[model samples]
Target: MKKQKIFALILPVIALGGLLTLNALKADPPSKSKPAVAGLTVPTGFDINVIADKLGSARHLVITPQNDIYVHMASTRVSKGIVVLHEEGGKTTIKTSFANYGGTGIAMGGGYLYASDKSGVFRYKLDANNQVTNPENPDRIVTGLVSVDWHQPKAITLDNDGNVYVNIGAPSNICDELDKNRTGCPLLDSAAGIWQFRTDKLNQSYKEGVHYAWGLRNVVGITWNQQLNQLFVMQHGRDNLHQMHPKLFTEKQSAELPAECMFAIKKGDNAGWPYVYYDWQKQKNMLGPEYGGDGVKPADAKYINPVVGFPGHLAPDGLLFYTGNQFPERYKNGAFIAFHGSWNRAPEPQAGYFVVFQPFKNGKPDGKWEVFADGFAGTEELKAQGRAEHRPTGLAQGPDGSLYITDDNKGTIYKVTYKK
Candidate 1:
């Protein structure tokens, strides 16, 4: 009977795959609106400004040395692909819009703008003026990436060593029980964790110098921490906490069991997913169900532990390490993470619709974290109505040491700065 049910589910997915051929589509241009500037109350010296609004699903952004902004806007019901915004004279001009290719990640390094589509990673050279004069041409840096339902975002970041790290999310919620009441582990035989590739190569497969770290579930936010000189990622935790194993978790436990994690990654390190999790309140490591122990204590000494843990399912989409002198000195060398908010913790009011700051000292967290910015949810009435004006997805720093944040749900980008 279980086999029959599994077969029934597989048939629809196969049919859908046949029906919808994957192709890049052009995204709609930004809607015209008054250049709006709304201020957000931060610390005693900081100021926030609304830079651009009414964009269509703005996901990630990277600023060039010239201060031009290249924003990756996801296609919506009417539009298809990527858009580049050039900033000049206190105004943003649409430099180019490519309707042919689409993906969620974008980065700029080595005088080239790199983007990832459903198929693979591509790179294009930007002129000194920060314009992509050549759109028809892009070097396929990495190819053969899977773009299925579960692990499709393909968030990426580049290290100073010219290595591009891409997160290939796990395709399963705990790998689907082998049998009812049984737990499964990560499938490292295929796509499950972070894969590294050289930025200069084209169409390079994962089998090259591309394997970095393993056992991460979905590390959407990846950045090279300049202060630490290491790779850091914010991981989305596994879901269906209590429903998967009723014997181990209650509904409340499932809703708030595992924590969304911030991991400091090194080559060949395994921050165990489907096997271990960092318990925040308890301030210790805990075993996952797949390896046999209850969700109480750390299971293995071999797995790497997360540097910090957050509330579960807040959907951390962007992370940035502060290196500017604009804000207070305490913000220097600290990290900023944008939580896109919760979708699964339904019966209980959802959480994490804000940005958080974690101070760093000598490549490690110095003390407790704090909410750096809030009120993106708009109003309590709106939240009760199941509607939010924005969901923060991306983070970027401007040339003048100001910070910018993008919201995917409402298609807006905000610039945060300091006044005193």
Candidate 2:
């Protein structure tokens, strides 16, 4: 037990060098009865394959025109912040070495590779081969964001117009008196929201960026909707509702209240976090526990409501507005969400380790969201110990219009293709 704890402490650094020596392992054939990709379900005529796996904490990913795939690592889960994978003859293999800072964001914009650790964002210039020119040293793009133990990942995205957006996740569960908010949570000033910066700018601090949106608790799932020319984000809802305010909320209510929300981000939007949360069942923004309100109370009228919402604690981590032509017409301009399941739903059994699709038309929600992909959890019923076989954390589209997903827990990457 002691050894296990210590090993977890230095997992990224210790396993990184050794893991790189591993030969590329082909994707296991999907099994209809198992958690395998074969077991997973997708739309008609769509197929999936695991290109790579056993990577330590692969987070977000980007596929360049050169067919090079760059995956960012979750801090403390992998040795390098960025891991490059190249494919030749249908098999993909990891590059030997790369960026050292741990992070959860990897994006390509303005001819540079952008990555982010817990508190900052950095970038590396790309060469003719679309490879980072200098892996050892990356230029600081945005600095001193925010990083407290919880929800610290600085997942980043870039718009087509060269603006960079960073998610500064709020660090606590509703910022109660017991947590970081004791003396007044200063994190609210620089965290729990989205900030916009110039992609070309270097050495810029948190204060330098424009606070584009607020009240977003933690937005690991963020993407620029190029089709609509807008930003979209999936905000992870707050937890610990019943534990903190047992008198007001039942365990079941806490498990399902405050639905994870998807927002069509417009400039100066405020979704209301820490002080309020969206109730999916109620279809209303309600006051947060810390702000003194019962579970049924309504929140401020000014706060924006999500375009779509899902059950609580599903932990949506990756968001992609599909503009690719490989999929059916129904999916065009629609959004795909990777739900990295969080087991707060306890005795009721955990849920979500799958991807959901939201159909959109004219840049707006046109119908109900539905499960587009499933079987990541590898189990019909969640175990009491609370763990999923694979949790999808990031999503990207390849040049050929194939969808790419990364599993942060196992460092797996899967490509989904559709054909008529």
Candidate 3:
């Protein structure tokens, strides 16, 4: 009977897949508003400004001490992958862009700007002014990382200890279909985890780097928390629960069961993907159906629980720990997450398309998370249709303690300031 039910759903699944792909590729109409803070919602005493716009697929960003901005472009208007900007007297202008390839991972450390394409990590020397001096002849630090068509972005961060961490996201969702016996997922050998590499090393490969952590399905938002002296990551939850395991989950249950989790990780922590998923409602890690259990069963004791679990499918693309003094004392040590929004959750009102703040106390989550800034999707109707005006993809902090957010949908760079 189970086999018959599964066989009956294959054609419908294929048709749905086609429709979803079409909807995803459909371009949204241009937004009409031109004001800096127009169509946005923020807390009192805070204001948002559009410092720059029309950048193509700006994913992650870094601000230098001089307040020079460097942004990674997954796609570009010109041939360059990194876009540089300079601000003076409250005005921002594009300085220049360089690099022959495009990607989503970029960081600055030790007078060098590090960037990654799909297959490798490269670094370029920076001048005294924090501008890339050798953009065309970057030194390849790490090479030969696995990258597929999806989940290919190697979101990166550097620690004060001269180490760089890169997230190699898992290609498969559940791996049930790939490893039919469910004994193990072969992809875990290289993907689905964070890998640590020395910032000073050159021409390093998978064998040269240490596998920092495993079992996280995919992590786009990653940071090294200086206060905690640990690595923190936001995991994107698995999708298609109802479509793949209809017997165990309803449509609503599928949309909301698994939680997008935040983990303050150590050297060998595992968050349990494919084998388990955190159910935010239960506040427990439930065994994945792919691993021969119903949704209610608890995951193995070896897997670590998340520091915080948010609603599923929020697609957290960026994470930044606030250490600036521009905001109130309450926000000094908190964390900000950029939700790129959700495409699934259909048959239910789609959600996300906002930034949220999670306060921290003594290097851990302190209180409930709150929406820090919202209305990126423009309207309820556009959000439901999965056509957003702007989707926040990256977060950065300026030298003067202002927060910067990047929109990948329409390429808008927002500067958020607090005036007390």
What's every prediction's RMSD, in angstroms?
A: 10.4, 7.1, 10.7
> 249-272, model 2: which lDDT tens digit per residue?
888888787799999889998888
Each model's TM-score, in the order given? Answer: 0.87, 0.89, 0.91
Poorest stretch of ten by lDDT in candidate 3: 4-13
**Clashing pairs in model 1?**
25-80, 26-80, 26-81, 26-99, 27-81
Best by lDDT: 3
Per-residue lDDT over 1-420 for candidate 1, one digit per residue giving the tens place of the 0 to 100 score: 010100000000011223221121223333334333222335555555555555568888988767666778765442345655555555554544564665578888887788887657888888877666566877888888767776787888888888888888877767645334545453664566888899988778867745789888888788999877899999898887677678887887777758889999999988777677667668667777666757775758888888988877888999999998778788888999999888787566777777888988988989888888776776665544446677888998888778888888856677777777
Candidate 3, 161-198: lDDT as tens digits: 88889999988888777798899999899999999999
Q: What is the lDDT of residue 394 in candidate 1?
A: 91
lDDT for predicted candidate 1 compared with the true structure: 0.72
**Top candidate when judged by TM-score against the true structure:** 3
Residue pairs in clash, model 2? 30-38, 31-38
Residue 316's lDDT in candidate 1: 92
Clashes counted in candidate 1 amount to 5
Tally clashes: model 3.
0
Q: What local lDDT score does residue 410 receive in model 1, on the 0 to 100 scale?
A: 59
